[model samples]
Target: MDRNSLIMSLPFRTSSPPLNWSSADCCNWEGIACDPRVAYNNLTNITGAIKILMRCKFLSVVLIGENFFHETIPSDDSIAHSNGFRNVQHLSIIGCHLTGQIPMWLSNLKKLKILRLNHNRITGSIPGWFSTLPRLKHLALTHNHFSGEFPKELCALPALISAQALENDTNTSILPLFSIFGRTIYQYNSVSSLWPGISLRNNSLGGKIPIEIGRLKLIRELDLSNNNFSGNIPSQMSELTNMERLDLSANRLSGEIPISLANLNFLAKFSVANNNLSGPIPSGTQLQTFSPLAYDGNAGLCGSPLPKECTHTVKSNKDKKTQDEKVGGHRIPWFQITVVLGFITGFWGVCSSLVLNCNWRNAYFQFLENLGDQLYVTMAVSWARLLRRLL
Candidate 1:
């Protein structure tokens, strides 16, 4: 098809006709990016025959999301000779009417970083080739009907930082032991890729989480919530020191929480609620710091943070012993005793000084009165003797 006809067929075309498609001037077209140097040469040479498909090599982004492009992507007919979306780094086809299995050819886009295909009716097992995309950092394939055991290869991508594959059910088991006739069979043979952080919540996945998952040391978030997963949370997960969020809620997991989880000091959110777990919750920095709500709904759990305290008789005896030690260790210091004595002595000294001062003042007044009386008597006797002699 001609480039103009193909462009017109795109669901993104608006009612207002695109800028004059009379000539192949991609620079004047909206949503059409072209190499400036190519456009400059084409403008000067006045060559209107150069197709945009040939000139779109310099395209950096292609946004066809939410445009109701209902059809299989990378269809053999549609992608026969075109590399239109080859160089584009971000591909978001969210809520598009697209269907069919995820294309294996999508793994060929080496530069793709973000692939969002959420909220669609897409079905089929997740392609194993997805692990080969080296630059893939964000992937969202939620709200689809994908089936099969979780692809272990996708968890091996080194550059995979965030992945969301929630709300899907694996219709078949990938366990080699369960395959028909004891012949070792590989269900999906694609390259091995590892993702650091992933979400596989609300799926029909049942079985123990693979112990190999702990190898993802850089993983920060892991959500396997609302699944039929059964077994103790792997102690190996303590190696994920960088993990910040962990949600394994609504599972059938049982057993005491692993003490090793306390080693994850960077953990900010931890939830194992709605599980069949029992025994005292692990104690230590990370576990103790979590609110009771994070460990709630486990009927058999008991500890300091939880309302159900430990019921072991030995614990009560230990508490009593510690209390006795504390009480016995409470001894009054000599300095405090000295301080109390000093206060009492100082109070008595002040009272005695007041009484002595009062007594001295009264005695001084009485002595002055006695001396005055004696002086008056001497004066009167002398005056009377002088009067008689004069008479």
Candidate 2:
């Protein structure tokens, strides 16, 4: 087909399609172009629906923002037969009012480097097949209703430089699965589902902090305020060697502050107030830099930044120690003396009772012996008198 015939076959939105077009007129069509690199090649097509398609081989960028193009993007299987845009490297369809799920055919663009589809009502989870795009660098899908867990496969992309996915309440557990520089950041939040590393400031996320979150060594900004997270801050969070901003305010966390958190060398903005946390605040170099507002509204917390000092904790510890020492010092000797005196007194009383009973028995035995001897003598005298009378 000639260049004009090819341009006429392509879909366009107008009252009536153009009918008259000469070979020379093909160069003037709104979306037609000819390859200048080749002396006689007339490759006519559309790009971004605005610029005339000249030199299809050399067409590298396509910007189709705010266009009236209305058609369901074909599936990957159908695009091979539909003669889809083959060579574009960058494609942006922002604010196009496009409807329906992201077509699987978009993955067919092997040369696509950047894809921007923000500010549209695109529904559906990000395609799992996007991992096939090796050269895809920048992906922007913010301000959409794409609901699901943060795709781990996307993070595994070797070429992904920047990724922006915010404002979606995808009901997936994001804490335990999240690993930035081999550290977990949602260690104490019990929320079954979390949007860790994202700006999830205003949402209905409820749960306790995952204890495995102290591993994100490279996280700079963490905004998890205005949620319903509760639990003690994990002491292992001190491992975030490069954390700069942390916001755990307006939640329901409780427990003594971990002393190990003072090891964070780069923490600048920190807040964990409006919760039920108790005990003294953690102290050290980075912790000293936080303002009073960082730990406000927690009535049970006390320390330097807070007006309530931890004298009770110190006093309680000291009192326990003193009581333990006093009990230890007095108990052994007193117990030993009581046991020894009891044994001696019990032996002397038994010996005195035996001696008195023996003396009484001895006197009674002497009196009985003398009475027996007198009875024997009286019986002998009576027998002698009776014998003499008989003689």
Tell me the alpha-carbon RMSD of every candidate. Answer: 21.1, 16.8
lDDT of 2: 0.56
Worst 10 residues of 1 by lDDT: 39-48
Candidate 1: where is the Cα deviation over 4 Å?
A: 10-84, 160-196, 313-391
Across 1-391, the per-residue lDDT of candidate 2 in tens digits comes to 3444454544543544345433333445453553221211222232222233322434445544444333333333434343344555556565555556677667766655556665455666667666576545445564455544334455433333223321231322222222122264444221222222333343334565555455444345556676666677777667766567677788777897788878877776788878888887876556756888888999998888788888763458867766665764663366678899999999877666767798766766787899999999999999999999999
Alpha-carbon TM-score of each model against the true structure: 0.56, 0.43
Q: Which window of ten consecutive residues has the lowest lDDT sum in model 2?
A: 35-44
lDDT of 1 by residue, 233-302 (tens): 8898888788888888888899988888888888777899899989888765668777888878999988
Runs in model 2 deviating more than 4 A are: 1-197, 313-391
Candidate 1 to truth, TM: 0.56
Clashes of 2: 22
Quantify how close model 2 is to the true structure by its C-alpha RMSD in Å. Answer: 16.8
In model 1, how many backbone clashes occur? 7
